[model samples]
Target chain A: MITCDMAVSIDGYVAGPNQRADAPFGDGVGDSLHQWMFEAAEENAAEIAAITDAGAFVMGRNMFGPGRGEWDLDWTGWWGPEPPYHAPVFVLTHHERSPVQMEGGTTFHFVTGGIEEAVTRARAAAGERDVSIAGGAATVNQALAAGLVDELRLHVAPVLLGQGERLFDGVGRTELTPAGVRQTALVTHLRYTLSRTAG
Target chain B: MITCDMAVSIDGYVAGPNQRADAPFGDGVGDSLHQWMFEAAEENAAEIAAITDAGAFVMGRNMFGPGRGEWDLDWTGWWGPEPPYHAPVFVLTHHERSPVQMEGGTTFHFVTGGIEEAVTRARAAAGERDVSIAGGAATVNQALAAGLVDELRLHVAPVLLGQGERLFDGVGRTELTPAGVRQTALVTHLRYTLSRTAG
Candidate 1:
């Protein structure tokens, strides 16, 4: 299943001004909000640790890095020498960058035809495992609207920013089934199983 | 529909350490999230403003804010002046906090029991709209495993933190259907319609 792993402030914000691109995230105020999962050095830590057949990830150019901001040009690579999301990561970008090959089995492919083609390639590469619509809100939104995602997980943090990048908006309404919930000292992890109620 | 509204660094980190108790919410890295949503300021912005009659909101104590960290105190009044989530918010806490009323229509209900109780109450309150499970990670994980959510919305930002909280961990096997996706200037909003697949 496709799971969207993200964080938000208790006040319902996603990130702060693009100016402080270095701040942990948009919440400008929170520190513990998105730290739980990324701290896990293990391969399973970055993801749910569930093994699937095999597929690639479809992502927006920004999801991988800032596509249009001033920082867009300076960013070398967000994930370090080896990022954990080790799969074929398809990035939707306008600027052309050579494919990036990582250590743990991740390759960044830049695609320009929006998300449909990205999913097609991801699924084909996945063979049977299932593709991941890796994000940047635009990418996930693209995947969802195209009816390409399968599951989504949100690790919501407790904090109120009063404002920031919101995860909801633009995308049409869709229904989901709550599969499970896990609480830790810092954040609450919500896992959702998606179902289509109508066309 | 459930939107996992959150923001993280380009490296996938949500916040910093300590989760400082004395610090104001929007004071640090976690505050970067929520820029887009607040700007939208839909009528329901602070009031669950959807006007769609979304029922109870599932929340973990940390998500509720206030008495987070190792102490696990029964601190309810997390939102300060007027808490955001106006619906019946279920706070998963080991300690008990009396339901407190806020300026808007928001009320905080503490739940020592698991997430099921929170979901049940939220569902009941949602008369027609739907139950929105606000997070903290643990709470969401429980809900996903139980299969109660109907939709998943993920807003992916442009930053990536090399470390921080993660949305999914040990989420086992779950399946879903992609409802739709939307591309925006800030975040990519992806909505996944849910379905039942496995435990």
Candidate 2:
């Protein structure tokens, strides 16, 4: 089973122009949706490190860089000196690139084969633990539509962009079953068990 | 002082089709983003009532309406019989209509003279309590741009809406200061004090 954990803006934007190419999650306000992740970093570290529940992570290339923006040679790691993901991370991209290594036992592997292929590798790397699909937007939707996700936890922010990007922008009718919910210190976490149930 | 409270889709859209006169909360699932507000109705009723130190509410006509697409004439009072908003509410619209009095001291008044005029009327009616502009998008932007809103407490949802009516579409550049942040059982409340800080 794969679970996708993401933090977003009230308006649905993950990160804005203010975000840095090197440290994508820069010192900006608002979109600090994932600040909870950082806050719970150590607490969840046991669960994350044990790999008893989850294994590898999958992300899109766009999330790594800013899509078509100019490249910054030194702008590889989004997280600071110690990136959070302590396991193997497979990023889907078009342009071939070398895998980058960072602190906290995390490595960025750029995969171009396909999403399924990347998932396959991720599962293999994950071993007994589940594979987590951590992403920006396009990647998650693709996995969701392909029925590749088992669990999805979403934190609905209280902000409204009134514009920007959308995740379910172009999807047909779908129904989600709520598995459980968690009210964090700064988030309303809604965990859903996705299934192709025709209601 | 006036404040706008809203829940919009990750696509920047507030309501979908507008034809579904019955439920104008945006796309079908878009209404999912409103789970907290609805739940807050049940759990936080006493708390909301206690802290609702506001004079009246200001919403767009679209929020109150005859809906957009199918005109089934279903008045959408998502908040149940006795609305939580016991105070008077002013709806912004171009058409004229009679006022509606409902349970729990809620009176729905329609205003057409424009946002400023509506604010003037609401502020005068509010006395000491703040004027809350609970909206559907266009209304919030209007009040924010007009420099009439004194505070904005946005509940950023976790969903991403690729498109829809955005809250900050043309808000331009305005300075706002985040005054406080609090987390409840279902939402992360960010209270921002709006100010014309820079001249």
i-RMSD per candidate, Å: 17.1, 6.7
**Would you list the C-alpha lDDT of every candidate in the order shown?**
0.55, 0.63
Give the per-residue lDDT digits (tens) of candidate 1, residues B87-177. 7777787766677766777777777777777676766776776677667555665666576666655554433232345454334334444
Per-residue CA lDDT of candidate 1, range A1-199, in tens?
4546556543334565562446535435455445555563252343345422246677776557644633344454577777666778877776666777887888877777767777777777777776766566556655655555567666655333434565543454344444555445445555565663311
Tens-place lDDT per residue, model 2, B5-107, is 6554434455554434555654454555566667667664543453455778877777666543433334635566687678888878776667778898888
TM-scores vs. true structure, each candidate: 0.46, 0.66
Ten-residue stretch with the least lDDT total in model 1 chain B: B43-52
lDDT of 2 at B80: 60
Query: Poorest 10 consecutive residues of model 2 chain A by lDDT?
Result: A43-52
Task: Give the per-residue lDDT digits (tens) of candidate 2, residues A15-49.
Answer: 44444455464334444555555676664453234
Computed on C-alpha atoms, the DockQ of candidate 1 is: 0.03
TM-scores computed on chain B for all candidates: 0.77, 0.79
DockQ of each: 0.03, 0.16
Residue A192 Cα positional deviation in candidate 1, in Å, after optimal superposition: 1.6
